[model samples]
Target: MNLTRTHAHAFDAFDHLATMVAVLRRDGRCVYVNAAFESVLGLPRRALQRGRVFDWFVDPATLKVTFDAVVANEFATARLEALLRRPPGAASTEPLPVHAIVTQIDHGEQVLLELVEIEQQTRQDRETRTLDQARITKELIRNLAHEIKNPLGGIRGAAQLLEMDLESKALREYTQVIIHEADRLQALVDRLLAPHRRPHMVSDVNIHEVLERVRALILAEFPKGLVVQRDYDTSLPEFRGDGEQLIQAVLNIVHNAAQALATRRQDDGDARIVLRTRAARQVTIERQRYRLALELHIEDNGPGVPPEIRDRIFFPLVSGRDGGSGLGLTLAQDFIQQHHGLIECESEPGCTLFKIQIPLP
Candidate 1:
């Protein structure tokens, strides 16, 4: 328990920490940095050790005040917001927004610096908001579907009666149109409420089977230009879930990707969609942590989701492609959520990944 004792194991544990941590001397030189810090900043520990900590901050003026406060013993700890310049070869080139704290770690002789990516926090907030929004959307859709049901039945019946009474074949075409339109609306309404009404039929589900079923369907639809490849962890354990619902949810996502690839590369035969699956340990979905979970990824090599509708794509009736019902993802999200899972999307030109994570029993 002596503070001065050399704890090799404790020091080594810092390298594997999830939080970004750096130890700095009072003169601003970084003495050591954890693996997470290096990974987030894309700067190696040696690189950080060679330079002053302030060199990494985009706004040195603000960081300087906090750095001085902790160094001067005026404050035991100081926190500030700053933009971090992304290192070369990073996924993004833009400066990253982060919450940084400088605190005395060794009686004012050394400072412990912690940097947290704002995006990480923001994403958690968004997930919470998304769950609430999904609940509200389902309620609204159910009410609207019920309201449309009675009138829709009446409209269809009236059209049928009008068609039967008409003598002229050409005039009867108008009544047929009315009936057809009513039927379409009714189908749409049913789709909107389908997830809410369908009972979850839980059973042991082999994820590979579901992926294979969807793959076959995709290949049958776009047999020539597109290829569906499988990347699965065969060791994954079977879990309890609604097999049919899971199939439908995965099918909707893979089908959407196939459709996008086909549309974007009508003449290119190299269009590809990968159905990948893996097991995740200690995963968090919808604010609840699970010891184990199954991760399924639907990735496509096509023009990514349209930027305009990307944020709203999961909302009912919001589609990136023309004539798309946009109910595919909405239903997919709902079905997965029912199983205590989450679906997330990340898209950029030529690469789009839809990740579905569900707890494993």
Candidate 2:
């Protein structure tokens, strides 16, 4: 084949796989569109070809900006993330999150536009907000704990001294009770401030390492019938994070699952815990796009979270388990947020999944 014919064939193959690519003339009319564009936009490829770009889309402001960028040619490429409102009579608006990139083609006579939908970005934003809120709450608790903790020790010591000086048995017993109660309160305060007080030793750590550590700990505690399985992506790159904090976060979730499987463990039945890891792209957290992220899932086969307390599980002092301090999951959430990540849970009978997504720096 001639060189020109070979190049044409190569272009044809490239266009087949490229995401929602289209060619437009200087007049903002669509000259060509790829098969992906037709499939994604739910429009006929022939209908879009030779059609005006603005006529098919609803947003005028978006069209103006996109067209201006293409006309200037100052930017070798430009990207705009916008919702592609479907044409009338379509089943849904669907909020098609298109990422449009303009590049000069056809010897500067036309621009090649590429569009890719990033729907996952919306879910990532929600997770990021949840993480931010958890961080704020943790910081507030840390500050309050510090304020109340110092005075508590002093009060407890004073009560102890009073008990020692009291000669009457009944009076001494009352002072002893005061000291005991103060000590209890001090212990609680310590737990509240634990996450903040602990020094973070950040290093390049593999998420799988942390998950494995959590799995080992849970199994050691409930080894008889509880089964822990690993489903990690070994290819995931090491992330810059505090190993101890990551361990604590994973352990908290795993431990909760183990505890929830108490009945199954007693019956010598299978109470399975799955640790999984995967890579995510174009993840948005706090309304910002993170090019790469790690998703760690801790799923368990146990009686799931109660509906009444599911929404409040991450809140301090909210525990579904009897005599539980309710701080494990809350602290886990705080630690993950500190590492620029979020933890989410989906629970139903016999299946509970806790997913933690952290942005890779």
Candidate 3:
């Protein structure tokens, strides 16, 4: 690779961009590559510069045609939707779908190519839907909870009055049932509206600390059978958020994992949950891009979330287990969203993974 050192300094500005950029000669000799491109290709800058840009695509012929037209001045720029080949050691074997933009550099012999991930739109769409659903769910729950609460207080007061008026023991016991049931319903309504009512306490929060607290709580509950593993990146910095809310959010997911592990424990299977954290770069949360974010994953080796309730796990009153209130995950989602974060889940037969992503300053 015969490259001038001056190119690196000139391309330094491109390094900050999230889009993948590459400067190349008309015949495909690489002049410079940006940081994002290096990450996407899973290769070092020197290695990437030595190879032709066309070689990175799964089908180089189409890129070759597009490249030639742009360089020959037939078109000042050309856009091609193509598949990019990933590194041999990449987790996914399939080629990455990307929209490639090729442009002629002004007053220069070099061509500029920018590649954007096509699947990024799909991810953004899912996030948009999740956010919209959460907003609607919150509004519906608040309205429903208040409606129930008003009638509940009236019924409980009437039951108490009737109990005092009754002289017979058996008749008083009947009134007692009504009062007890009304109180239970009132408690349920309070829990339903707890997130909206509570004040968000803001402070610098360490993600690992939150995970450690959740780990301790999970272990205490299943000390003998469960093992909590940690794979943490110490480089993650603290961010402003509600520490208690984060703790409760993580604990809810971890506790759910422990509950799912009960079947494995009965069979003497290894019940394990892994708490992993890393500093994610160039992430978009709630449609806002951040230079850095905390990616925390709580994964369990147990029976996966039931298929029926997997999609609606964050909805109020939806539970995967028998007698489960299903409010744990709902509250957790609400708490995280209030911090401008999101929680996502993926489950199969033996693996259930819950990912929590929050932006960091």
The top-ranked prediction according to TM-score is 3
**lDDT tens digits, residues 288-353, model 1?**
867689999999998999998888878999988778998999999999998899999999999999
Which residue ranges in model 1 land beyond 4 Å of their true spot? 1-77, 82-97, 101-115, 263-266
Better of 1 and 3 by lDDT: 3
RMSD of each: 4.9, 7.5, 2.9
Candidate 1 TM-score, true structure as reference? 0.74
Write one digit per residue (lDDT tens) for candidate 3, span 230-328: 999998888999999999999999998999999776677589999999888888888888888889999998889889887788999999888998899
Question: lDDT (0-100) at residue 331 of candidate 2?
Answer: 86
* lDDT (0 to 1) per candidate: 0.85, 0.79, 0.89
Lowest summed-lDDT stretch of 10 residues in model 2?
7-16
Write down the TM-score for model 2. Answer: 0.70
lDDT tens digits by residue: candidate 2, 1-361: 5743543454564344435777777888876776667766677866777477766555757766767776777666677766676765677766576666778786678787777667544455566666667767777888888899889889888988887788999998888888888888888998898876788898999888888778888878887988899887899999899999999888988999999998888886788889989987555556655768999999988999999998779989889899999999998988887887888899999999998889985
Of the two candidates 1 and 2, the one with more favorable lDDT, higher being better, is 1
Candidate 1 displacement at residue 58 in angstroms? 10
Local distance difference test, candidate 3: 0.89
